[model samples]
Target: MTTAQRLPASLTPLDTALAAVLRDVAAVTPVELALTEALHCIAAEMAPLRAHPPQDLAVTDGWAMRANDLVGASSYAPLPLTAPPLWVEAGSTMPTGADCVVDAGAVDAAGPIAQVLAEAIPGQGVRRAGSDIAEGRTVMEAGRPVLPRDLLLARAAGLATLRVRRPRLRLINIPGGEATAAFIADAARLAGADVIRSDAPGRDAAAIAAALDASADLIVTIGGSGVGRIDAAVAALSARGEVIAHGIALQPGRTAALGRIGTTPVVALPGAPDHAFAVWWALVLPVLDRLLGRGRRRTQALPLARKIASTVGIAEVTLLARLQGSWRTLAIGDLSLDAITRADAVLIVPGTSEGFAAGTDVDAYILRE
Candidate 1:
């Protein structure tokens, strides 16, 4: 019988299944790598070795003078300086007793003395010491993915490397599931996982079982998750290790399964693109976050532009688009390729709740940076 024709024997609650998937899974060991190598990896706590702008510095290429010396000095009535003020270039350390910088034209260094024609404020055009980065403060908190802007701060602080955690993930693609496998691989990489992808030799339980490798921190098998005659991923996992959950109470991903080979966690995703996509967000992300020690995810609070009706017994994935400062519901339950492609955020409706009413303020996870 086909998967559509067969009724699931029992469905495990999404929360129960997720908890099992994360059981005993610990964060990967953190490593200190060069900034170039740590890009996109989860950042470990980083404290600046030294403060930025080690001393008071000039923010402009001009003359550095005490503000009091240049006060009330203007073009109409120039103030003659006892001596030419120190000339400092942009980013250069400001001279002692100089709390402000004046442009070149503001000071005329002709004849026997220099005349100042610009009024200056105490801190005008000056970058104070430790203003950019403090010595005792942490450069970045742990769990946020390293970004280019983060590298800028590290470079300025004279740091050659940063500590980060990158979890290794293995993706097993069953025969005829290349598209979904590739899609999931890209998404995993975007989430800072080091993805290793391989194809199962055949469709049988033995072939899928042979492809399972416990070396990776996590293993995800695509396809063969349903109860159809050809579906054998769950059986393959059971043969090698214990299956935690066979069926999950997730719309479009009900056939998904969770298991473990030895200590490494394993997840079997449905072959369909939409179904796999839902499972990736709902089930797989939690496992990935746990492995990487990610603290929190980006979420946005916005009112719903339309009402969302979902069955109370099963968890549903809702795709949304940001429009006119509110979240516009694009797809719920069975997601289409177009809807998934156009979605800017995702909201999961719990099994206990009936649905969210229109204009209800909801917190949805941001899909894009």
Candidate 2:
């Protein structure tokens, strides 16, 4: 689609814009990777190759013996073992004919003979094979992101490698808006993408087209989405592919644009750091999450410390701070970097609502950084 219009009335709703950007997006191809290198990657498939422990084993350092042989034994009258006691440590395999373990402290070993003062029970202090993880059990389902703690389970299951999906991203800086390129790239990397960055001066259409032609799964361009004279992202995008959205009904990010260059999705963000930051999470993050097979963001319901107002038709994105065990929207005249840096979470005011009263419960998306 060509640059048909650029008016505020033409802006799309946040939800509609997100749907358009992600309608055709899919997870990247999966590949085999070493278990150590699969952190934050999405698992294609995972299963245990072997059962943990692999056999019945002792759970404590004690003497292994038949439970029936130690019956009726007590501190008053101990039962003497006919043969040498079989010594076993924790995690050691249980010997044949051994069904229980007597604590070492409760047994007196006088040379070859041993005396047990307590009765032992069958299956006591023993861990059966497959108790922790059964062979061929599913460790993780396809499209689930791998976490650090998952590696421990995978290692115990005897998995040396895993199949994962890691999407590649291309970032472009338009003209004088090179300041936030690195920051955006870092955010993309944190979202589990390999990023390649380029700079296009004076709304260079050729540079933008060249970046799109790269073999990246997604392309992101900073700046050049506004109605200003220097704005050429819309033109460049139309010249090469389709512009799905030219604007969104969002504060500090109304100029954001979404489109596609062939099969690769392209996102155009505003130049300002705060605007780009807000828009990236609101719009770009969904695309990345879909391509990486990540789950939805976890949110917490918190009461507002103060009233927050917004325009009737535009969605306002606000930063939140935890104060006195309550969340308050960061009220700033201009959406600046300093304001965002002081916040701990993100609060969204939908376009249908004009404002929220103090003490109103709202869902806040936790910010890891």
**Tens digit of lDDT per residue, candidate 2, span 264-303?**
8888998888889878888888898888877667677888
TM-score of each: 0.93, 0.86
**CA lDDT, candidate 2, residue 339:** 72
Worst 10 residues of 1 by lDDT: 1-10
The most accurate candidate by TM-score is: 1
Candidate of highest lDDT: 1
Tens digits of lDDT, candidate 1, 97-196: 9999989999988868989998989989999998999878765889998899988988888889898998999999999889999999999988889999
Q: Which ten residues in a row have the lowest lDDT in candidate 2?
A: 1-10
Clash numbers, per candidate: 0, 0
What Cα-based lDDT does every candidate model obtain?
Answer: 0.90, 0.81
Each candidate: RMSD: 2.5, 3.5
